[model samples]
Structures are given as structure tokens and as C-alpha cells.
Target: MYLNLTPKQMVRLNLALAVLFSGVGVYGLQSDSLPISPYTCFTLAIACVVQAYYSTEKFVAKAALSNTITATDTSLTVKQVYYQCEKEEIVELSRISQLKVADNYLAVILDGNGQGYDFQIKGKAEAIIERLNEVLPKALLKNSPIKQV
Candidate 1:
């Protein structure tokens, strides 16, 4: 089975904010009437660009996850494509620690190192949670539930 995930809305919002900040910076550099210093505006713009870059990375990861998550009878393969590079991690079913469901995200926790891979849950969150619950072993399910925020 293959499961797909969607990116969060905040990613687009961050990109939009980045563009807006850059425009403001350019405008500040051109206009004299504005009280804000060009240096300040430029700094803000750079910060926004950094924010947008990180958000873009998150968006790319989400997009990659959307196409990944291939589950076979014995193992689950997670493929991530970022910056034109493709990475794959294959885990045996027995090595899975737990499937955690929160209000907006789902996390797959690996057994030994307790590492987690989180995927944003868009529409039909309940159905996806239920499906995960049904597929994974009861022993692997986390006893402590995540609080929905």
C-alpha cells in the first residue's frame, strides 16, 4: 500500500511573506520618506528569505512524502526527494515502534533509536489514522497518546 501526505498551509504563507518583505526592502531602498532604515529593511528581507528557504525545504519534504511511503508485506520504504536528490529508508515491520496521531500530524516512530518521521495530515485525518491503526501491529502502538492541540 502507498500512503500520500500533503504540505501544510504555512509553507505558502511563509513564501508569500518572504516576497512581501523583499518588496518592502526594495521599496525602502528607493523611497526617502519612509522612517525605516534601508539596512533594517534589508535585514528583514534577508531574514524572510531564510524563513522562506526553510519553509520551502519543509514543503519539498512534504511533497516527497506525498509520493513515498510504500508499504510491502515485510517492510516499509520511505523515499524523500529534496534539492534534486533522492534518499530512501527501508524498515522492517518489526522495527517500527509506533504510529502516533496528533490533531494535525502523523508520526512514525522507529524502534531502536526512537527516531520519528512526521507527516502533515490534511483532509480526512481520521480515516488515515484509522487505516494506520488497522495496519500496524498492536504491540508497536504507543501507549501514551498524543494530545490534540
Candidate 2:
């Protein structure tokens, strides 16, 4: 079974916030009456730029993941994008430990380890959960924790 997921709207919101913060920082630096010191304004501007860069990077990464998950009876392959580059991770089904469904995200645990990768669900979390239920191993899903939104 193949599953494709897209980035949620929060990505865009973060981008917008980044821009707003940057503008405020720049304006603060230019306005003498603003009461904020030049150093403070500069620091704020740098922070905002850093946030914007990360937000844009996150958006790109999520966009690149569109329809990149491919799962077979034996293994699952996930293609992830980072800074315009593509990376693939392949895992054997036998290595999967469990799946966790939270309010608006899903996590795939591997090798009976507590660590895992998380994906944010775009819409209707229940639908995604149901589809996953059909495609994933019954044992993995049986004792999984699903949080209510």
C-alpha cells in the first residue's frame, strides 16, 4: 500500500509569522523613538531571519514528501526532502515495533525502540488512522495508543 502526505497549514502560518517578526525588527531598528536599543533590534532581526529560514526549509521538506511513502508486505520506503535534496529510508516490516496516533500526528516506531519518525496529518486524522489500520500489521496496531482530537 502507498500513502502520500502533505504538509499542514501550520507551515504557511509559521512563514507568515517569520515575515511579521522580521518586519517589526527592521522597523524597530530604524525608529529612534521605539525605545529599543540598536543592538536589541539587530539581535531580533537576526533571530527573525533564522526563524524564517527554518520555516521555509520546513515547507520545502514537507512539499517534497508529497506521495513518497511506499509500503509493501515486506518493507516500507519513505522518501524525505531536506533543503531541496531527497533522501530515502527503507525499513523492513519485521523491524517495525508499533504505530502511534496522536491528535494530529502519526509516529512509526521501529526495532522495538522508543525512538521513531513522526508525520503530521493534513486533515481528518481518523481517515488516516483508518487507512493505516488497513495497511499496517494487525499486531502493531492492536495495542497502539490513539489519542482523541
Candidate 3:
């Protein structure tokens, strides 16, 4: 199951912020005396718009299951899609060598390969962290305690 981790008002707030930033950028570009760069404001506006897209929680595609495995296998491949903006890959928890949890982020390391995926936790971190705790291994959090939000 997919869960939305962003606050309900975040979408509106981000869009509003995008509008404000874009307007600022435009105004800044019009005047040569402004201390702030118009390009910087435009960049911030684009960033806000991207965050708004992420906060919207829209599903783009579902994961596909294939590549048959033997019956003796301990873990199987399953598709997990977070959001359209984030990566959607075939990652099994059993393959994870390390897990990092925090108020604003979650990181999973795979099989000591020095490669990992990091997810940014937004809005209500507690709820998302709790859900992750449910689906993920308890041992992953034994060392790292999630800070209260």
C-alpha cells in the first residue's frame, strides 16, 4: 500500500510560494537595483513547484513482477512505487544491510555495496516513520532512534 507523507495544506502552500517567488523573480529582473538575483528567485520558484508536485502524491505507475525464482528463495522481488518524482525500484528488505531513520529522512543500504536509497521525510514524520517501522525490520532501528517531530 502507498501512503502520502505530506501534509494536506502543503500543496497549496508550496504553489502559493511558487507564485510568490516567481513574481519576485520577475520584479527583480525588471529592476537593476535589487540586491537579489532574478534567476535565484526563479530557481526558488521552480524548486517550490517541484516540492508541490512531490507533495501532491500522485501515482504514476505500478511495479511489475517477473523474473521467476525458485521455491526455496527466502525473499522475492516486488515493486514499490513511492511517487512519480522519486525512484521506483526493485529493493528487498532482506538485502538491506543498514537502515537509517530520522525525523526528516530515511536511508536504506543494500548488502554493504556502498549504494543506498535515501527518502526525504516531510510533514508528519511520525506517521511515516511508524509505518516504515511496521514494514521494515526492527533490528534496523535498534541502533538509531527516530527523533521526535
Candidate 4:
């Protein structure tokens, strides 16, 4: 099962890039014919290659869940692999007092002993939250039953 990014996203990205760098590529191509310093053309070509590499990586991640979660008896392991441009964080499911799926991210409420970090699953936030609810053991998810203290 693979989750794909919407076609509209791809189309919009392509259109934006076309508008952004088409002139640069065309200028480089035209200048290469003029027989001046070849460095400008080389630089432009390199820039295009780098841009393609970056976009390809982003598209791959946007197309699927780059991270994985494995539920265990005592705790849940959330191995979140973020894109190179993105940041990654480690989270222990035992510390999570609550889990909420918001519009675009997962809000993992942590316990006081930990730093109380909220783990955000980037693309498939809802799916990840559902999977966690399904696969996580009852003990890890059990709270104190709301005792009045």
C-alpha cells in the first residue's frame, strides 16, 4: 500500500519551477552558443541537476510515509525518518499521555518525566495515529483512569 501525493501538488510544483528556472536554463543554453566563459553554462547545468535531485527526494517522501512504527509490549518504537531538509525527533510511546490527530500533524502528549515532546508525523499523520491506536498495547496506552485528587 503506497500513499501518493496529490497530482495537483506535483503539477503546481512543476509549474512553479518552470516559471522559476526556465529562463536560467534558456539563458545558459543561449550563452553557451556565444563562446564566452563556459563556466556560466556549467554552473547553470549543475544548478539544474542539484535542483532535480532535491525535488526528486522531496517527491519521494511526499509520496509515502518515510517513517515506521512498531508496537511492543512495554513501549512503541517510532522510527521517524524525515527528509534531509526536515528535522527528526525520537519519541517514546510510554510517555504519551494522549494522542490527537490534528489537521496536518499528530499531537503526542508526553508525560512530565520526559521533555514532553510532541511527535509530529509529517505526511500520513492521521494514518499513523490510527495505526498507533490499533497496534499499541493496552498497557502502554492506559492512563490512571482520571482519579479525583
lDDT of each: 0.59, 0.59, 0.57, 0.52
Instruction: Give residue 140's error in model 2 in angstroms.
Output: 6.4
Ranking by lDDT: 1, 2, 3, 4
Q: Candidate 4 at 102: error in angstroms?
A: 1.7
Q: Write one digit per residue (lDDT tens) for candidate 4, span 34-80.
A: 54444554555556545454446454554344344555565655544
lDDT of 3 at 55: 63
Leading candidate by TM-score: 3
How good is model 1 by TM-score?
0.46
The model with the greater TM-score, 1 or 3, is 3
- Model 4 TM-score relative to the real fold: 0.47
lDDT of 1 by residue, 3-45 (tens): 2422344456666676777777788888887788867766776
Model 2: clashing residue pairs? none
- TM-scores of the models, in the given order? 0.46, 0.47, 0.49, 0.47
State the lDDT of candidate 3 residue by residue for 1-149, as single tens digits. 75544544777888999999999899988888888899999999999987776666342113111211111123322233454433434466566666555654556677778587765544245555565555544554564344343
Clashing pairs in 4: none
Better of 3 and 4 by TM-score: 3
